[model samples]
Target: MANEAATRLEDVRANIEKACKPSRREPDDVTLIAVSKTHPAEKISPLLEAGHRVFGENRVQEAQQKWPALREAYPGVELHLIGQLQSNKAEDAVALFDCIHALDRVSLVKALGKAMDKAGKRVPCFIQVNIGQEEQKGGCAVSDLPSLIELARSADIPIAGLMCIPPFDIEPAPFFAYLAKLASDNGLEQLSMGMSGDYETAVMLGSTHVRVGTALFGERRKQEQ
Candidate 1:
């Protein structure tokens, strides 16, 4: 498993380098937070051993169970929450993850701020924007971003950037570009959009972070949890 993971990581690194070079960017310019949401903790140790320090999880519950042991074992792995986070779970989320990537609304922002205060740490977060405006998605609509950004900024909960996942049928660049503009217009510095299928396009459009899952771990086995 360790050898397999190393080989896989090399493949990803090569792909990222290729993707970056064509766009006149370095692979390191974009941070790849491997989305390990469904994979078990033991199954991911090889990835950690291979020097893949950053990981992303879609839920707090799974992370709460997995990270405590993983952290004790690895000591330097960084966990990122990359899913729609309920306000009620904000405290636990902030206390556990190094970054939260799905901060979608002002209420969540306010909740995270209050939660951060109690945690004695200013938790970094991204304002998720529904750039595609899909009804089934989790984010503030693009039109509402300004006000949301304002509210988040006023609270000063470490507004690190903007995040989004484009609708499946469309090209991700325009949506990603929209996020870059939102970050620029609002004077924010990071763009945390794109994933396995569209990450190259995202890198070309100046995405600072990409959440990659299948491309890194292959297809996940559905766990009967």
Candidate 2:
């Protein structure tokens, strides 16, 4: 398992390098977040042994179950919450995640603000935008982004950047590009875009962070919740 994980990590790094060439961006500029949402800790351990440090989890509960021991065993592992976060889980999310990529609403901003204040830990957050305007996505509508950013800033939520998942089965470059533009317009520096499938394109288009799961860990063993 370690060997396979190492091989896949090398492949992904090489692809990132290739993607960086055209943009004159160093591969180091892009942080690879292995999305280990549904996978158990045993499966994740091998990658940690292989020296992968950053990981993404889609649920607060599942991550709570698996990460504490792993983090104890291997210090300095960065965890990101890449799923839609409920306002009720704000304190737990603030306590557990080092970064959050799904800050989408004003209510959530207020919740996270209070949570951060109580915990005395300010987690960097990326505002998720409904770039595709897809009804099923969990992101702030494009029209509401400015107001949302202002609210988050006022609440002292430490806005890091913008995040998005383009509608599946379509070319993702345009969506990635649009997201970059939005971040630029808003004076945000970090972009948490791309996934296992289109991370290379995302890198070429100024993605500072890419969340990869299947490509690094192979197929998920169970359905993502």
Candidate 3:
């Protein structure tokens, strides 16, 4: 298992380098966030041994439970919340994760601000955009981004950039392109848009962060609740 995970990690890094070479962007220029949601800490330990430290989780509860043990076992791992966090879990989430990716609404922003105030710690956050206008996703509508960005800027937390998940079956470039435009228009340059399936397109479209799973960890298992 360790050997396989190491091989896959090397392959993914090579792919990133190959994909971004045309743009003059070194693979190191993009941060690869291994999306470990639903995968156990035991399964993740090998990757950590292989020198991969950044891991992304989708749920605050799952992370709170899973990471403490992992942190004790491997103290250097960085946890990033890449899911739509419930405002009610704001305090705990802010305390647990190093960064957050799906902060779209103003209400969540305010809630996290209050939570950070209580904790006296600010977590880095990304503004999520519903670039596809999909009703099922939990991001702010594309039209409302400027206002959200303004709100994020006024808050004490540092706004890292933008994150978006394009519709599953569509070409990821247009969606990535839209995020790139949004970031450019707002004078922000970081774009986090990509996954195991379409990260090459994402790199081609100027993604600063690529959230990858499956390809790195094989298929995801059912997460224990």
Candidate 4:
């Protein structure tokens, strides 16, 4: 398992490097966040052993359960919250996560701002845009983006950049391009876009951070309700 983790990490790094070539972006300019959601700590240990210091988690509670010990052992592990964040989890998320990728709505922005103030920690945040305007997604509507960004800034949340999940079963380049434009218009630099499937394309399109899961950890086991 440890050997497999190291090999997969190497492959993903190589892919990122290859993807960066055409775009003229160096691999160091992009961060590969290994999404470790739903995987047990034991499963994650191998990747840490492989020297992957950045990881993403879907839930605060699950991260809280496993990460303290892991961080104790593997110092400098950067934890990012890459899932839909409930308003109520703001404080815990602020305290736990090094960065946030799902700052979608007004309520969440407000909550996270307050939480950061309370914790004296300025956690960087990516404003999520519902790029496809899909009904089932967690991001804010594209039209509502400017106001949310302004609000987060007013509330003192550190705006890292923009984030989005283009609709599944679609060519994601246009969506990624639009997100890059949005970030530019908003005067932000960092972009947290892409996942396991199309991250190579995402890197080519200017994603500063690619959240990868299945490629790094293998397919996740279905979670129970």
Candidate 5:
């Protein structure tokens, strides 16, 4: 298991380098967030042992249930929340995540602000955009993005960048380009876009962060949460 984890991590890093070369971007420019959601600690530890420090989770509660021990065991592991957040769980989210990739609505902004104040810890956030405008997806509408960005800014939440999950099963390059443009227009630098299947395309388009899971962990275990 440990050898398997290290080999996968190495392969992913090589892919990142290959993606960066044509664009004249350095491999170091992209942060690979190994998405560990639904996978247990036993699965995650090998990657940790292989020296991967950044990981992503889909839910705050699940992360709360699993990450404390992992964090204690591996100092410097950075946890990012890649799922939608509820206002009521702001404090818990603030306590657990090092960064948030789905800060989309006004209430969450307010809640996180207050939570940060109370905890004396500020968590940086990525304003999630509904790049494909899918009704079932969770992200700020493109038209509403400016206001939401402004609102998060007003509340003094650290804006890490913009994040989006482009509509699945379609060519994703255009959506990724559009997201890069939006980030540029907003004066933001980090972009939390791409996943296992399309991260190379995302890297070519200037993604600063890629959330990859299946390629790194093989597949997620059944969710018990």
Candidate 6:
């Protein structure tokens, strides 16, 4: 298991390097977030042993249940919440995640602001934009982005940058480029775009963070009936 994890990590890093070459950016400029949602701690431990420090999870509850012990064993592990955030879970999300890539609404902005003040810890957040205008997606509408950014700033949430999940089965470059432009227009610096399949293209276009799951962990094991 450990060997497999190491091999996958190497592959991902190599791809990141290859992607960086054409873009004239260093591989170090991009942070690879191994998405560990649904995977158990045992499966994640090997990657930690392989020196992976950044990870992302989809749910606040699942992360709360699994991360405490793992964090104790592997200090300095950075956790990112890369899923849609419920406004009610703002406090827990602020408390658990070092960064959040799904800040999408005004209510959440207010909730996270209050949570941060109470916790005395400011978690960097990415404003998620519905880049594809998909009806089922969790990001804020493209037209609402400017207002959302302003609200987040007024509420004192550290706006790290922008994040998006382009509609699947389409060329993602344009969406990634759009997000990059949006961030620039808002005077933001970080971009949490890309995933296992599109990360290389994302890197070339200006992604500061890539959330990879299947590429790093392989197919997630089927749940027991």
Q: In model 6, which range of ten residues has the least summed lDDT?
A: 216-225
Residues forming the 10-long window of minimal summed lDDT in candidate 3? 216-225
Model 6 clash number: 0
* Model 6, residue pairs in steric clash: none
RMSD of 2: 1.0
lDDT of 3 by residue, 95-123 (tens): 99999999989889999999998999988
Model 6, 114-186: lDDT tens digits are 9999999999999999999999999999899999999999988899999999999999999999999999998
TM-scores of all candidate predictions against the true structure: 0.95, 0.98, 0.96, 0.98, 0.97, 0.98
Per-model CA lDDT versus the true structure: 0.86, 0.95, 0.89, 0.94, 0.94, 0.95
Residue 201 error for model 2, in Å? 0.6
Quality of model 1 by C-alpha lDDT? 0.86
Q: Candidate 1's residue-wise lDDT over 1-225, tens digit each?
A: 888888888877777777787668888888888988878877789899998999999999999988898888887888899999999999999899999999888789889988988888887899888888789999998788888878877877888899999999787778887888889998998989878888778887888888988877878766623
- Report per-prediction Cα RMSD to one decimal: 1.4, 1.0, 1.5, 1.1, 1.3, 1.2
What overall lDDT, based on C-alpha atoms, would model 4 receive against the true structure? 0.94
Off by over 4 Å in 5: 221-225
Estimate, for each residue in 50-77, the C-alpha lDDT of model 4 and write its tens digit.
9999999999999999999999999999
Cα lDDT tens digits, model 5, 1-225, are 999999999999999999999999999999999999888899999999999999999899889988999999999999999998999999999999999999998888999999999999989999999999999999999999999988988888999999999999999999999999999999999999999999999999999999999999996546643
Off by over 4 Å in 2: 222-225
Q: In angstroms, how far off is 116's CA in candidate 2?
A: 0.6
Off by over 4 Å in 6: none
At residue 45, what lDDT does model 2 achieve?
A: 92
TM-score of 2: 0.98
Worst 10 residues of 4 by lDDT: 216-225
- CA lDDT of 65 in candidate 1? 87
Candidate 4 displacement at residue 196 in angstroms: 1.0
Q: Which structure is stronger by lDDT: 1 or 4? A: 4
